[model samples]
Target: MRIAIAGAGLAGLSTAWLLDPLHHTVLFEPQERLGGHSHTVTAEVDGHETPIDLGAQHISPTAFPALANLLDAVGLTQDLIPVPLSTTLQVHDAATGRPEVLLAGPHTADPGWPRTPVLGAAAGSLTALVTRAAEWETRDVSWERSLDELIEPLEVPRDHKDRLLYPLLASFVGCDIAEAREMSARAAMAFVLRVPPASPDTAPLWHNLKNGLGSLTTALAADLHHGEIHPGRGVDHVRRGRDGLDIIDTRGHHHHVDRLVLAIPPGEAARLLEPLAGTSAVCAALGTFDYVDVTVTAHTDPTYLPADRRHWSTNTITVHNGWSETTTWYGPINGAQAFKSWTTHRPQPPREPLADATFRQLRLTPAAIRARDVVGQAQGDGGVHFAGHYLQDIDSQESALLSAIATTQRIAPDSPRLTDMLTRAPHASDPPEKG
Candidate 1:
C-alpha cells in the first residue's frame, strides 16, 4: 500500500514508522527537520551542552505505557524521573520589588496558605471543586455536561471562579480564560484527579522522559527504511481523483497515493478536505474542534518570573494583563540558564528570546469531545484516514502512538509488526487525569 501522511508530528512519524516494513509511505513536512512538536535545541550550559526542549517536552512512562513500550521496542531507553508538580500563582509589585503570593498548589514553593479573604475563599473553593469533581467523575454521565454547567451547581463565587480557578484551567489547555470556561467538565476533573498524593509520603510513579523527545522522533524517522521523508515539502491540499487521491505539495508538485492520512489537527484537516464532496460530515465534525495558539520562548529572562526569588518554583504562573502565563525554570546553567515562557498567553513578551515556536492545541470543550467521537466514527472512510492524539481515547503521547498503531492496522492490517505491537506489546494503562 502507498500511504501519504500530512504533518510530521509524533502521530504522522509513528504511522510511517509502523508501516515501513511492508508498505511504501511518504511524509510531507514543511520544516527542514522531521519532528513536529518533538523539537529540541541544544545550548551550552555551564560549559556543558544540554538539550532544551521547547515543545512536547515530557511524558510519564508509567501513565503513558504504550509510549514507553514503543520507545523500548525502538531501543531508546535512557532517563526517567518523577514529574515535578510544583506550581505557584503570584504577581510582582514592581515598585515594592516583592511578590504578593496569591495561591499555591501541591509542592508549591511556600506551604504557608494565603490569608487574604478572597484568596482564602478561593483555596477553600478549590478543595470543594476537587471534592465535587471526584464525586461526579465516576458517574460516567458527568462527562456529557459542560464545565460551566457543573460549576453552576457548586455556586462558586464569580470572583473565585474568574480571578483564580479559570486561569489555572486555561493554563492546562494553553488557552485563555474564555476558552477554558467552555471546556468539558471532565477536562477540569482530569486535572484535579491527576494531582499526586501528599508529596514524598505517597507519590504516584509517573516519570518524565528526561532524554528529550527529539531522540524519540529521530529514532522513529531513522527506522523508516521503506518511507521517504520530504523535509521542505508540505501538502498544500488533497483532491479525490477517479484512481486515487492527488496530493498537491507547497512547491506545486502533485503526488498520487492509494491512501491519504491526515495526521494534522482537526481544524487543518477540515480545511484540507473542504473541496471534496461527501466530506461535509467529517468537516462539520472537525469544525466543532478548535485550537488556540501557544507560543513558547526559550530565554534567560528572570523578569518573566516573580521578582522575589522565594516565589520561583518549577512552574511559576504570572497573571499579567488579566492573562495567566507560565514561565518554567528549565535549567540551572550559569550563563546558559534557560527559563522558557509561553508568550502567547501574555501581552508583554519575554525579553532576549533565544528560540520561539508557536503550536496549536485542541481546546477540550464538550463540543470538541463530542466531535472526537464523530471523527472516530468516520475513520477510514473514502480511502482517507485520520491519525492524531485528539482522535485517540486520551489526548497524550500514548494516545498518539495508539492512534498510529490503530490507523496502520486499518491501512495494513496484515502488517506483522503492527499486529505484534497491538497484540503482544504493552499498551497505555488509562492515564490518571493530570492538569
Candidate 2:
C-alpha cells in the first residue's frame, strides 16, 4: 500500500515508522523541523550546549508503556531519566499587591505542608480527588462530570482550585483556566489517577528524556528507512480521484497515494480536508477540537522561580489576577537554574532568551470523546485516516504514539513488523489513559 502521511510530528513519524518496511510511505510537514510538540532547543551555556524542551517533556513508563516500547525500538530508551515534577505555588493578593507563599513542594521534604491549615485541607482534598478518579476508573460517571464539579464539593481554598489545579490542568490540555475548569473530569483526573503526583511519601511516577524529548522525534526520522519525509513543505489540501487521491503540496506540486493520514492538529487537518471528497464525518470530528494560544520560553532566568530558593520545586507556579503562570526548572538535571515558562497570560519572552515558541494546544473535553468516536468510525473512510494526541483518550506524547499504533493497526494488520511490534510490547492494546 502506498500511504501518504501529513505532519511529521510524533504520530505521523511513528505511523510511517511502522508501515514503511512493509509499505511505501511519504510524509509532508510544513515546518523545516520534524518534531511538532517534541521540540528541543539547544543553548550555549558557558560553552556547553544544553538541550531544552519547550513542550511534552514528561512521560510515565508504567502508565504508558507503548511509547517506552517505541523508545526501545528506536534504541533511545537509555536516554530516559526518572524525574520528579513537584510543584510550589505563589499567589498574588489583588488588594494588597503582595504575594503569599503557598504550599512548599513535597520535593523539598518540607514537613510543614500538613501544619498549615490551607495546605492540610488541600492535601486531603487532593487525595479525595485522586480517589474519585480511581473510582471513575472503575465506574462510568466521569464522562458527564467536569473538574469544577468535582472540585466544588472539596471545599478547599479558592487558591488551590484557581491557582494550582487550574494551571496544572490547563497546561495538560493547552487551554485557559476557564476551559480547564470546564473540561471533562475524566480528561483532568485520568492523568493524576495513573501518574502519581510528585510527593515525598511516594516514588517518582514520571520520566524525562535526558537529551530532551526531541531525541524521540529525531530518532524516529533517522530510523525511517522506507519512507520519504518532506520537511519545509506540506500538503496544503487533497482531492479525490477516480482511482486514488491527489495530495497537493504547499508549492503547488501534486503526488498520488492510496491512503492519507493526517498527523497535524485538528484545525490544520480540517482545513486540508475541505477540498477533499466525502469527508463530512471526518470534518465533523476534526472540528470538535478546540485550541488555545500559548507561548513557551526557555531561559536561565532566576526570577521565574519563587523568591525563596528553598521552596523551589521542579515546577514553580505564580498566580496573578485570576490566571497562573508556570516555570519548569531543570536545575536538578545539570545543577543550574535553567527553566521553561509557559502561560495563557503572562510575561512575553525575555530579550535574547534561549528559545521562544508559540503553539495552539489542544483543549480536550467531553466533545473530544464524541469526536474520537466519529473519527473511529471513519478511520478508513475514502482512504483518509487520523492520528495524533488530540484524538486519544488523553493528550500526551504516549497518546500520540498510541494513535499511530491504532491507525497503523487499521492500515495494515498483516505486516510482519507491526506483528512483531505488538507482540514485543506489553499491554500493547491498552490505551495509555487507562494505565
Deviation (Å) of 382 in candidate 1: 1.8
RMSD to truth, every model: 4.6, 4.1
Q: What tens-digit string does per-residue lDDT give for candidate 2 at 1-435? A: 789999988999999999968899999999999898888998876677888888778887788788878877777676776666676667777788776766554652335332222255556656666676677778777575787877777666776677666766665655666778878888787776786655545434477777898998888888777899899899987999767888999989999999999999987888888776677777877898777777888888767565667667777777776566778887655544578888457644544468888877776777777778887887778888999998777778888998999999999987666776788866333222211
- Residues 240-285, model 1: lDDT tens digits: 8777899999999989999999988888899999898988988999
> Which candidate should be chosen as best, given lDDT against the real structure?
2
**Candidate 2: what lDDT?**
0.76
lDDT of candidate model 1 versus the reference: 0.72
CA deviation > 4 Å runs, candidate 1: 91-99, 108-123, 155-158, 198-206, 331-336, 345-347, 424-435
Q: What is the Cα-based TM-score of model 2?
A: 0.91
**Best candidate according to TM-score:** 2
Against the hidden reference, what TM-scores do the models get? 0.86, 0.91
